[model samples]
Target: MRSDLQQILATTDFHSSFDNAVPLMTHLSAVRPNTLIADCGDFFEGTGYYRLGRGVLERDMLLALYDVVAPGNHGWPHYLESELHRITVCANAYGRDGRRLFRPVDVRSIAGRTVAVTGIIGVQAFNAVPYGQRVGQRVTDPALALRELKRAYGQVDAWVVLSHSGFEEDLRLAEACPFLDIVFAGHCHSDAYGPVRIGGVQVLKGYEQGAGFAQARPSESGWEAGAARFADASSLSLPNTLEAVRARITAIARDLREPIDKVRAPYRHTVLDRRLLLEDIATTVYSETSSAVLLNETALRAVQLHGTLTRGDVLAVEPFGNQLVSVNCPERTATSLVSDLSALAGPMVVVPSPLPSPLNAFITTDYLAGALHLPAVPTGRSLAQSVQQALTGGTR
Candidate 1:
């Protein structure tokens, strides 16, 4: 009976877990012997390590550990490269050179059974593309990607889709293909406790930063899947390479005392009142693109700060890897957006007032824009770029 059960472990939305990266891999490796480990994407660009290291330092560590990987919306282009994604299985992503970045499907032998894994991202990206990374690259329609993967690896004993696409997309995929047995959902950032059944498929989701990975073990009739029970890995020790990266990060922190500008009254960001900050950010975007700025209030997830401003301070306030995008929408929709946002507190948003009947709008993040169903054009100007330009060498 024990021999009949096989374990497949997975993690999604790591966002560059600097702490205990390799040691966590060690822990995972030792925890489940002969288990096939897979990582769903959005695995980079959160902490200072990404900013300083360009994700290479942590990328190498992840390469050594994960058996197969998928590129999330934020971890695109870089993670799509050959070195990191050689064992990857992403159906939708392509390079600017018009080449498929990774193998569409991976088949692994686990517990005398064949386990197949593949990945798909949201139709719209959560993170904007960094400059000079890849020009004119496209993530092909995910629905088509799944059909392609299905035709290729349809006969596998157990199949899993690491879906960075939202929950609804996963449900659609599950309905389209009855062969799919399990789905690990991402992009929504939910810590789903149990499985949501759609046809024969069981979908599970883990929270941000590997709150805990998903664990799926074989059952008598099918697989049993859910979030793993464990402590957050933030306190654990990192591997030697990452420890060295930490050392560099610490050193960099020492020299970060240079003041960029001064702040008036500490320009605090509070949920109770976000008007001042939004208007400030919107004004900047308005100047750059000549578009009314609309931003998801979640962009300012930092605590109150008012004092001498540093480069670090600005980056901390706009911590997400979002870029400014220009969108053309009916001015009335702007009113509708603010109205809808006013009604809901969870997904708060801000749009500059008195929009022209037909006007151009500047947006901050794709995740929010997509959720709001706004049409946008990519500007390639990142949040860091906007902050540096807005608050650098200038008092506010």
Candidate 2:
């Protein structure tokens, strides 16, 4: 008989996988009794479903899983002091007993050995957010947090970091913190699996949106502990119990999609008007809204220079959920921002070229310079600075 120590099942990028998680959880439970189920991160935000107030969809899904949970970025935005209290109160009410429901770290004893699972939301919440928005949240700094995690090295036989940080940061953490044995990561929607040995530490990203779960066992020589298991959630159809739970969630999402009464104008941007539109959208609007105006300005400049933009393009340019905010900056600060935008527009910056439409003539010379490397330099500035300065005038 195989030694029945502890089995670890973890999922990441579960952006409201609440309904979908039921079947996955049920299957996992049936296969491995008393295993640790962890919802890594992005459980709440970034989906059209949540935008329709379907965060409750995720909340209900988590309620059913009966496992250890940790904070993701999506969960953080909705986190209020009151909500935290309510979550604790409700977990107690639900008769699901464990320190797993809403805690940063949980330690479990299995198969005569203790294991520690430490969950960290990605640093994007800080580095990616616009300036003023990152305030007052108790986020663990990845570098400092790793030091703390090191303290627990000898305390537990296995240390797992359940992270919502993107792949790069997670890999960095895994390399930096040799004490960590496994890292289950999310964000960046990377469908990577297996033991990615980064400086001898094995890191794993279990794909996204509850598509699957990653299972690993510790062997005598670290994570090479034989073949790890990656179970695909899509491979299994809904079981009867899960079918019922899923129906409830689908009905809720369906009901929420009904149109609400709100008066809003349709947003329009055309090739002829895109430069002007981008100028307004970036400097006058987005800059005022977020902390990192330079970042926003770079994105807008890319859009304005290239007349064609897509939803994906917009997202790539501004992935962070930065809102429009303005702070008073002295002329020097504003000047520095202009300089930064100029640097971002240099020849090395490979911007997307617009499709040739009949509307190309309407594009300004400045926009053309950055987009097509046109030699039309405005009287007194570098190619990059001239384009950026011209964009501010709305004439572009």
Candidate 3:
């Protein structure tokens, strides 16, 4: 550990769960003087706040807090916005004309020691983004980019990577880029919270959805890193400075909680049983459009709905704002489409227990249609609407 540096704090994959904003911000504000605050991206597009508020809140929060950030596939476009673009650092992303998309490294004097903070988006994660959203954008191999950056910024005391790649991919990255001191990982939502050392590099991530952060402080060996939850900060009150932001968030959340419908029984969705919720929505879409439906579990979140349902509940269930689109599938390609989708998205919900061989057409999200390279006819409806219908047993 360097004598000049104090501590580093970072959040990853915060998918617009602003319910934690006050406490999180209160904590961040308290620690801002000595702590280097950063985020590993996917900050936008998750709950009703992002869906209905349209990223204003997310952008505002970033402007108010983050010092540096990495871009994630979920909020790929948001990183391009001028305010965020200025703070974003990425080593690999490039435009079609071969121009670097963002500053490869952000060098700052953390205390007195020169520290270089660089970011990289995994190739697989970048490709997972909707094609249209990433038009004219391309990425090189993350390790390749890091190697180039290391040579370019050779004078830094410490090299830290804010990676939008999953935790496992980062372990491999750490092995490849042994020059790195610490790797803060994001994008793959799994139970693995590791400061798992790989070839002398430390790799870990914060608990996602604004619940926690990853922290690093100077240790005798090098840097000791671990995950920290925001539970202690839950009781913290917002300062007068952030009260306005808190009010706006409250107003928007209240609107999102406005009742839209009712449910007779509780319908629960959890990580273990995401398929049940997807199956229910698939049935609704199938019944409405009279077409086979394909829905991946990742498109929707796991939530429990009961009694009076609100827009927030619906959006929480299917947070990405996906729209249903119809795509034609010939008999010859139908089987292969199912197989390929199964491979790409594990254990997806396919309407019709056994897909009919002569399936003429099927319904899927616009994102999936683009991913599959299939021409789609827009149904002029959103998956969130279908979720509402499914729960209420009626049309919106």
Note the residue pairs that clash in candidate 3: none
The Cα error of candidate 2 at residue 112, in Å, is 3.4
Ranking by lDDT: 3, 1, 2
Q: Write the per-residue lDDT of candidate 3 for residues 157-275, one digit (tens) a residue.
A: 88889999999999999999999989999999989888999987999999999889998775667787899887666567766757777888999989888987666344632232467
Q: Best candidate, TM-score-wise?
A: 3
Expressed as tens digits, the lDDT of each residue in 1-396 for candidate 1 is: 123326777777777655435445545645545566777787876654566567776577566557777777666767756788686778887777887767788776666767788887765542234423535566877777777777876667888888887666777777876778888877666535347888778988765564567777767778888876445444566567556655765654554445676654425232213445656667866765566666656555443445666655655556566767766555545556656534432444344566554544556565455545567678877765665444443423
Off by over 4 Å in 3: 1-5, 232-241, 266-273
User: Which digits, one per residue and each the tens of the lDDT, describe model 2 over residues 1-396?
Assistant: 224646677776666544355556556656555566666666675433454444665665555553565555455544333443233211110112422234445667655557777666655533333222333333446656656655645567777777767777778888778777787766656555656787666777665665566666655665542123344455565556556667766775465344322211222232223344344433432233332222223333232223333332332233333332222333333334334435534222211222122221111223323322323323232222222233333222
Model 1, residue pairs in steric clash: 20-238, 266-306
Model 3, residue 147: C-alpha shift (Å): 0.7
Q: How many clashing residue pairs appear in each of the predictions shown?
A: 2, 8, 0
Q: Whose lDDT is higher: candidate 1's or candidate 2's?
A: 1
For each candidate, what TM-score against the reference?
0.72, 0.57, 0.93
**lDDT (0 to 1) per candidate:** 0.64, 0.48, 0.84
Question: Positional deviation of 357 in candidate 3, in angstroms?
Answer: 3.3
The clash number for model 2 is 8
